[model samples]
Target: MNKLLFIALCAASGTTCAQTPATNPMPDGSRDMYVGLGVQSAPRWDGTGSRKVSALPVLQVQWSNGLFISGMSAGMHLSTDPVIEYGPLLAVQPGRDASGTGRSADGVGTYGPSLIGPVPEPLAKFDARPTRLDGMDKIGTRLTGGVFANYYVTPQWRLTSSLLYGAGNDHDGARLDLGVQRLAVDLGGQHHVSLSAGVAVANRNYNQTYFGVTAAEAARSRFTRYDAGGGLQDAHVGVRWNWAWSPSWMLTSNVQAKRLLGSADKSPLAERSTNLTVSTAIAYRF
Candidate 1:
């Protein structure tokens, strides 16, 4: 899967090599909408496993007046164990043990030698079970939408930023992206290629309680509730290539590298690792 994604990225970059910038015709007065489909994968960040694949569908609408909106949705089946570990001490109580052993339910079992007595029963039935926790095997979809504003820094340079919100069946988050794109213009008066790069940060929340603890009798032995809070999601760097195929049509390809940062593990559905993503699309302007 990684190989295939790499191949697609290569093709996109290779196409850029053939483009020779031309003069912008609709330069500052055009509106366009693009819809495309592609493939995506979330690979293990620790470098010890296989990559998972998914389907990606995206839509983007833009205007020369600097207003734009875009949306993307993808689905994947992935897994991870975001476990927090604690101590290994056993808990016992004094007096209740009948042998006068100095022990407590707070897990101070090694403070003294074991004494022959009836073990103090746990205050809570589930206290006998293990604590600390992690999550694994996540299958879900992620949907993202955003509005952007662009400013023309120069006839050939533009800066853009957007506020984005993302939601999933099992995952939800918000993101912000800031970037610049430049259209290289040659003397021929035809726009042939463009280059863009950006940085994005996101925050996501996971439904850990749904998968963490159980209230059912059959699951009582395997469940323990753990708090999973959201945090800085992922940071990414991306580049795109625009190839004008004709007067009103073009093919655009994008490649991005994403790194899971900060407390990403707090979200059970997050891969909580770094990955590289590449995609492509073809659009037309009227």
Candidate 2:
């Protein structure tokens, strides 16, 4: 196992999952990894007020070759500079069905095929619950390509941005995320906390697929027809705490709050414009 270290940040929202790992300088041919499971409570869907609890799987890894995978995202670090980092990125955008968003607590879904293969939606029993997406069309899982760049003013503060394309039912959707983070603040003993706040901007195709109600959809669903334009989709703030119990064991917990913006907040399917997602997991290093 690699030395005890903490070096990743990931935030999830209705529209996107942002995974940003700090650059780690490790020995050649070595790696650091963590894998575990936990639970998460989040809204049934993006705009729904109802919430559901499901299993949460934790996976984070970084190799000596400038490659890393955190949560559902994978990317390579091409910059050697200590102050700035940039590289190509690829991510799996979960699909959506009548029940809710394809990704469950464990990051599995079944609306369509994932480029990496599906993990099979587990909480299907939750389908019995009513959701605003009941009569909506199924959106396929998408493999999005993008780039990520981060600027560090110091080791503890960073500015982050990423642009990803290829989402939505038609696969023409795109999103850009911008945020600032205060990372790894020691709070006595083995506890550490990190904070972040960001905003996501999306294109018309993306917003429409997730929020708009077409005439046909309105006819079938309870919602009235509505058009959602491209713009700022949501703003979010998050905090994460890590408690290291040993060289190989640690508990990680996170809480995030998001509020829909612009047209996304006005969609008929949006029962609530604001929501919170909370999760906790225990991981073992390898």
Candidate 3:
């Protein structure tokens, strides 16, 4: 039941988005791994109109004991059933700063070297820019804990869900992601593509941390005070293409589009409600 297909899927989707790899059954001590590098073009932040290009690091590994690492998440499978998969998960949530530059967990090291460090300070604190988040408090990177479960409707289709907490500065943020994946679709030769669509829901704390603005912040920043409530956050769709040129070498790529909804979309920080992220890399199977 080795699900190699998810390797490319996770790589393209920003591994920190929180996903559980399919169960991989192997010899008592064997493992599977993939590592590579690529580039991604994505919005500076969740709702900003600005976009930036960053380096993407691809890494997915699963051991026979069920422990696995995919992008910025690590978890262990607890089920042996082919039709159902469950596991405890841990992930890193990227932080946000006044510069409107953050989101490190999009992929392993995709957001530059600021991954584990404190969010950078805004350089233009006195330059009242219309789009800058200056005067806002910096949100540091957080480690979230949760679980994931997936049910196979058939060999080619599956439903996926994961819940995680401990996001945001207060560490009270929580989020749930629900989605479905259409496994590999043969395109002849050694090429295949997978499709996925999903929606995210978050608690008030989670939404507020990213989208809300306090009175204190409003006094300094350009945005007025806003209190974001809990509800649907975003909807997304993605496609992954994998071309296995050889048994050990393959070209993997992904394109994902996401749109903010509810309070998140209406936030003053949201210069745009919709955005797209794209990445591609060449990986080696070991």
Candidate 4:
């Protein structure tokens, strides 16, 4: 439930991509792999304040040694204690700068190019308003690597935390997340429900790169100049459901609500602080 894992919703694949490992541990000599497709609604830009829906792929692999891959993240387990899981973490932090330019599988824009673009113009303009907010500087993807720690207080209660440092030039800043999760898995393994609540923090550089407006940007976007500082960026809660339809087939879905915090909430680009994201996918396990 780390808020930094998605770009304005579903930009790459068909859905917003976020994966929380399943409740059961892997059998010592076996592995479990799940592949899913989900859709999530996110802000139009990194602080744009408005939201749209996008779909993306989801996957998670848990192997013998506690090594796991979940969506855009992978890490190794450092502890043998069944109650606590922690180790090195590597992840991709999604970035954004487009004003609805994201594409979907049909080769059309995610929000539909007809209303935005795939062309040289704005489809809808409000008294010369759309032109001013037409374009933006592109934000490249970032590769982040760091440490992750999680504690399981009980079979159904968990605490998750992570710290990552960005390696990409796009937004070379650090990010941190702290969250708690609760999972309910039926003894028959036929159903599952999960809830997670967390908050994410970004450093000054990260905040500025994504939310700050330089003079040139102000001139281009027509938004007044604004400088953003680092601190708590977002707080979110997620509710997920899973159903095992058969021995190897499963279905999953989730809804997440996120609210901008601190400077991220006050940025001129923000339209609203509360963004609701939802996703669903059918997956397979072997």
The candidate scoring highest on lDDT is 2
Clashing pairs in 4: 10-54, 14-55, 14-56, 15-55, 15-56, 49-271
| Superposition-based RMSD of candidate 1 using all C-alpha atoms, in angstroms | 21.5
lDDT-based ranking: 2, 3, 4, 1
lDDT of 4 by residue, 132-156 (tens): 2444465566667888777777766
Where model 4 places Cα greater than 4 Å from the true spot, the runs are 1-29, 46-50, 100-135, 167-171, 185-189
Alpha-carbon RMSD of each model: 21.5, 7.3, 6.4, 8.1
Q: By TM-score, rank the candidates, best first.
A: 2, 3, 4, 1
Tens digits of lDDT, candidate 2, 220-258: 877779999999988777777788898788888877777
Cα error of candidate 4 at position 14, Å: 14
Q: State residue 61's C-alpha deviation in candidate 3, in Å.
A: 0.5
Q: Which sections of candidate 3 miss by over 4 Å?
A: 7-15, 101-131
TM-score of 1: 0.44
Model 4 superposed RMSD (Cα): 8.1
What's the true lDDT of residue 19 in model 4?
A: 34
192-271: candidate 1 lDDT, tens digit per residue: 33344444444434322222222341233333333444444334444444555665555555554544445443322232
Better of 1 and 4 by lDDT: 4
- Stretch of 10 with least lDDT, candidate 4: 106-115
Q: Estimate each model's TM-score.
A: 0.44, 0.88, 0.88, 0.78
Colliding residue pairs in candidate 1? 22-190, 23-189, 23-190
Best-fitting candidate, scored by TM-score: 2
